[model samples]
Target chain A: MTAAATAAGAAPRRSARRRLALVLEPYLYTVPSVFLIALIMLVPLAVGLSYAFRDLVLLDPDSGGFVGLDNFRTLAADAAFWNALGNTVTWTVSSVVLQFGLGLVLALLLDVPFRGRGLVQALVFLPWAVPSFLSGLDWAWLFNPVVGPLPHWFVALGLMTTPDNLLSSPDHAIWGPIAANVWWGVPFFAITLLAALQSIPPDLYEAAAMDGAGAVRRFRAITLPFLAPTIAITIMLRTVWIANFADLIVVMTRGGPADSTQILSSYIFTQAFQRLDFGYASAVAAVLLVLLLAYAAVLVTLRQTFLARR
Target chain B: MRAHVLRRRLFRVLHAGLLACFLVFALFPLFWLLKVSVTPNDLLYSEGVRLWPSRITFDHYASVIAHTEFPLFFRNSAIVSSSTALLSTLVASGAGYGFSRFAFRGRAAIVGLMLVSQMFPLVMIVAPIFRLLSPLGLTDSLTGLVVVYTAFNVPFATFLMQSFFDGIPRDLEEAAMIDGAKRFQALRLVVLPLTLPGLAATLGFVFTAAWSELLFALMLNSSAAASTFPVGLLAFVSKFSVDFGQMMAAGVLALIPVCALFFVIQRYLVQGLTAGAVKG
Candidate 1:
């Protein structure tokens, strides 16, 4: 009734000026955001896209000339690009799988009635609250081979000999950041899934119990299906985050140990900022943009399907 | 009934044990941070494998503050983060409201473009951004960091704020308009009041993001005068030796503003501020 009344009363066509004002209202609210976004975001992006085609120097602006896919050609053969690409894939896959796995288990456990539940929830969520850089720094310290608690304990227990800096080893450097990423990222997955869990009706579980369904069977048949959409969205978001994250790498390894831990983002940083290769960096960025666009398309499709059923 | 009771008790015990183990795993790092920050430098290696240190001191904290450039870094970080948060929230709120309410030309494209902006790695844009800012004399300035952070943050922040605005009902504005209010006045009186929680959340989110951002800060600013806390922390690790005590102390101090900010605005952070603002 209120919707109908508001719709009829504010139709605005009663006066031409009022109608025009109504038409302009939405645009006015949007103008400031649109202007800032255009200037700071859109224009820079256009500039970047153009750079992909031009030979550009970071220090010398006047050096840029239309190169016509030269940057792309260079990146295609670059050994570092392939290596970084491989590392990025490995990093994203491992981190996402472990994070979701741990998060789902934690969420399931937290879903059950238990003592100190609130305290546990708060404690688990603490890592998420800490800044990512600080969390990375904290882990960097804990994984320090010289005086870190973890390595020290391992040495004393005869687990490993002497000082072994995880970040200094090619095989383990990436894992240090991966561990920190999981520590921080698990909470997001847990919270989102927990919210979804709370919304699942208890009657379904009761019905399952009455049918003598075991706990694993009930979870598989009842819980998993309902949680699929949330889980999918969580994975998509985390994949994008993990793929692009550079802070942890910068803090823990700085893409070091012979660039073993270098992912695409860090590689791009090195190319652009460290090497001052503006044109190449833009091309690399454009590649990342393409990958992300594909990811976003899948996400949109998933959201549509989920919403359609709802 | 007795058998059922026994099974239920067993399940409870299992749940308790699992959660307890996970909690310890999750919290061990934070506990270790505190433990190491207080452990004296000499005992750091000497007290190997011990759960608790035999002794603790505030000397690290005292040295970090009094002897280092941490205070300047803290001040610079404060200025940059707070400004970015305030500006981005204000900008995002306005944009979000427009997106939520208006069906203007190119609106969808604009939003899609913003999403595209978010996908590219910041590393890709760093050199171009630096080149773009250098001519404007923004390099090595705190204002440069603010501009960069605000640009990077505004899109996501706008999306977040738009979700909030979408939750607010259009009826409130219509009713106010019916009672003889201009559109801006109606928005100011009716809509803005309800957007407080959203505004607070956006501010807190962006502030924390800018506070810890390092790449742009490192690339854009070179001098200690303009360096933020993250960059300042890097200064503690010289070529010859890393002062773990001072570095950890600085890391601990950086948590203060973030913790205090979260403590103050956590009500908005946790609350589903959109509830009751819209109808299903």
Candidate 2:
């Protein structure tokens, strides 16, 4: 019964209670998660933000005083910071481009009907399950001059002058981590893209086939458009995520061979963990947060404008 | 007509070849890890880039099991991940169900809050989380890791569970309710059984995430006993002078559980994921 009936005194109070409960059900259902996230994530996030403006070193008891923007000032002039910013761009772009391109190819391949497709899908997607840190280490091992075949293959293919470890080369060192990242992350793109592909109506293809469209022509006319939105969003999300991702870099090179691979995130890690510079690390983190938010805003606006134009 | 047939045949060959390349690219490093893990010590250097070792031995695996702190780390990882998965799933399913079924007050606000959690650099929160947990004596314990991981995972897990819940018809519970069962009771009796695969998918995803987490595991747990597999594996890497075979064996061992969980859950992943806010 409606609240009107309850006011008319025809409905029992038990049914009224049930109605009230129904009204509150969503709150009751979601409150636990909201509470937990508030306590664990938001509280700590507040504390972390507080650290950005304060002088808080872990080992130093006397270092809890407020130091407004001092670390940010230091950051402005820091050469390592500048280098890391440049490297973050290079790393994020290369990793996303490689992973996305390769993943799309893989996804399209899987979308085709074939024998053992299920098993093959599972196998290809297996790399996504291998822990990021392990993939980093595994790829690092694969590039080791002594044991791995990659460097040997590189030499044989005439791509390298010697069978030397790629991790030690300052110029090409970033690619090592990027390659590993591509290996680990391609499955993520493939899975998402394949999901998108599966959702595409099959009869569209059948209809196009009836119209005498070639494979490439039909794909260009249909598949690409269907995948565009998925591609755009995935690229944006993965770009931000890859920029923040530092585990592979840290594990493989520790920002390596003279900080060649020190993206902003890994730089933050090194400052915080290795040097115990929490305040500075948090400063770097705050800057990164602002940068990411700005990036996200731009991407969202671009997507909006693009949609409007379409 | 014969030219068209030959072109199709050529394209088929090309596709097969490209797929083979992808398969090798995906699987080769894993195969190398396994090969190294099994190669006998004498043949390790002698093998030098060979696909298969002349001699195979389980000594590395045996040694890793018998003579190391890996078992303790493995156990700790399992405890933390499983606890995180269970707790996150329980809490997230409730939230997801609400989101899926209702359009109530503060729904948008709550969703925006969860999305905010996904936005920030989580490293920013590490120090603060450490400070918050340390005073409560939660640091260096598996429980600490579980709580943190559960919170970290809840956002994605909620979205995932919401998708799964969204897929299920609400009429199942409504029909039960019409027969005099409470809504919660109907949910338990009628709806819950249907969501088992969805629940399993969420559980396995969260488990895999928690198991592989390195940074928080490193920061929160100072003790060897509390360190998860990632931390232990990282520590093992520093001992490069020590047997390479044993290290790879530990890496292989670490890869096993998550891979198995993922293999089981992979089918559900796309469907469950696509149903929710996967676009964002």
Candidate 3:
């Protein structure tokens, strides 16, 4: 019996090593991708951090001097920085709110069965399929003072005497980009929320109806809880996208009409590429990174708290 | 009973009306794009808010195709977008599978790090990226644009693919393995076949992303030879006046490839979106 037990143990040990080998083999498949990611993403991240403290000029190609905190100090006093920051916050918050509100409303409306339902759903999702740059340009054309259909429609309808180029003014320029963003973003929220809406079992609604619950009451009791998780995740993703978005701004305004529509991302581009101040740009970027990290952390915490209660 | 019936009908009518309004609101821009594209340049401003132009002509499309650099821009965009899509999908699939199935020592850390990567604004890192790429003789090249786009897009693509993989069950692969197949064989035979919708979705998403990408293309490539369509569109905007008709014509033309690609891959996209919507 003892000898038999010893042989069994020895056999299992050999198989365990084989299992280890098997696991290692699966991991080896990921090596090429991991290496490339490290090279392109991870290394640049490290370089960015290091460059934030070093004065690197684009023209000279060899001029890099270590200047700790100077970039941050300069950025502190920079009026454009404050304006961009404010614009970025406004863009992110308003776009996110309108996106969620309109998306939720559309999702709710689509939740009910009606004629041409599939066609309506597809049409509502059209904006998402269009390219962001093209969308920006499209909006720019629509908002064009002379030839745009929007201002023309407004004037024809007696909303204004003359066509206003909204993108030309500081106050309205930021809203132009926001309007463009909202057009593109609402579809994602609608789709995601609609998915979440569909996942709630119909039986629950039937049961609520049997219990004499009305439409709004049933939604309050059953639908909202089930959709909360999806809503939270979608909002987090949209916030991140909006906060860092540059293409739309670049295409529409170029952070222009006197930098009124400049967000952090476009501002960083100007600092780095246009001004040729790599170090200062890096510092600004680093600050942006920290804020995003904080935002993500808060989102994760919120999600955790929400989940913990369940 | 009659009142209840009337209320139900009212609700139905309201729902349909609301959906119709939303649909029109959403699709108006696309409709206008098509409307303006076919409208002659002469009546662009003078037409004054007509739903359809007084007369339609294909002159702008003809001119854009024949008279401008539109074809070259389209070709360059196609090459860059398609290559980036294929290459990134391949890379992302491997990484995504690892993330979905494997339980390595640093798996959680790696996933977290990838999330962190998404948080950094691209503008923040554009300088360092340019600096790094300049030394490799990649700046102002199509290959450079592809590489940068692939790098920027892979993380999101990987996450997207990973979600797809996670939706697929593990039992199929285990069954294949039990049937005397090696792990890779099981993956190739059973898993890869099931992941086709995911692969197609990732390809389409990455392709569109790369095609429409302008900022990096603008900052990275200055020469006309390597310029993509979005960058090419910038040429229409000189210091003095913007060419609205030609730019709109070019924009309309640029939509064709994306529309065509989406049409081909629409099946996969629908499948991908609907796959994880409902529980099995």
lDDT score for candidate 3 against the true structure = 0.81
Off by over 4 Å in 2: A1-12, A305-310, B170-181, B240-242, B274-280
Per-candidate iRMS values, in order, are 3.4, 1.9, 2.8
Task: Evaluate residue B137 in candidate 3 and report its C-alpha lDDT on the 0 to 100 scale.
Answer: 92
Per-model RMSD to reference: 5.1, 3.0, 3.6
lDDT by residue (B200-227, candidate 2, tens digit) is 9899989999999999999899999899
Docking class of 2: medium
Give the clash count for model 1: 0
List, residue by residue over A1-310, the lDDT tens digit for candidate 2. Answer: 6888767775577788878987988899999999999999998877887888888788898998999989889999999999999999999999999999999999999888889888888888899889899999899989997768999999999999989999999999999999999999999899878878887889999999999999899999998877777787778778888988889999999998899989999999888888888899889888887887788778778877766776
Candidate 1 per-residue C-alpha lDDT over B53-88 given as tens digits, one digit per residue, 9 for 90 to 100: 899999999988888888999999999999999989
Residue B258, candidate 2: C-alpha displacement in angstroms? 1.3
In model 1, how well does chain A match by TM-score? Answer: 0.86
* DockQ category of candidate 1: acceptable
Query: What's the best-to-worst order under DockQ?
Result: 2, 3, 1
Compute each candidate's TM-score over C-alphas. 0.87, 0.94, 0.92
DockQ for every prediction shown: 0.42, 0.62, 0.48
Q: Number of the top candidate by DockQ?
A: 2
**Each candidate's chain A: what TM-score?**
0.86, 0.92, 0.90
Worst 10 residues of 2 chain A by lDDT: A5-14
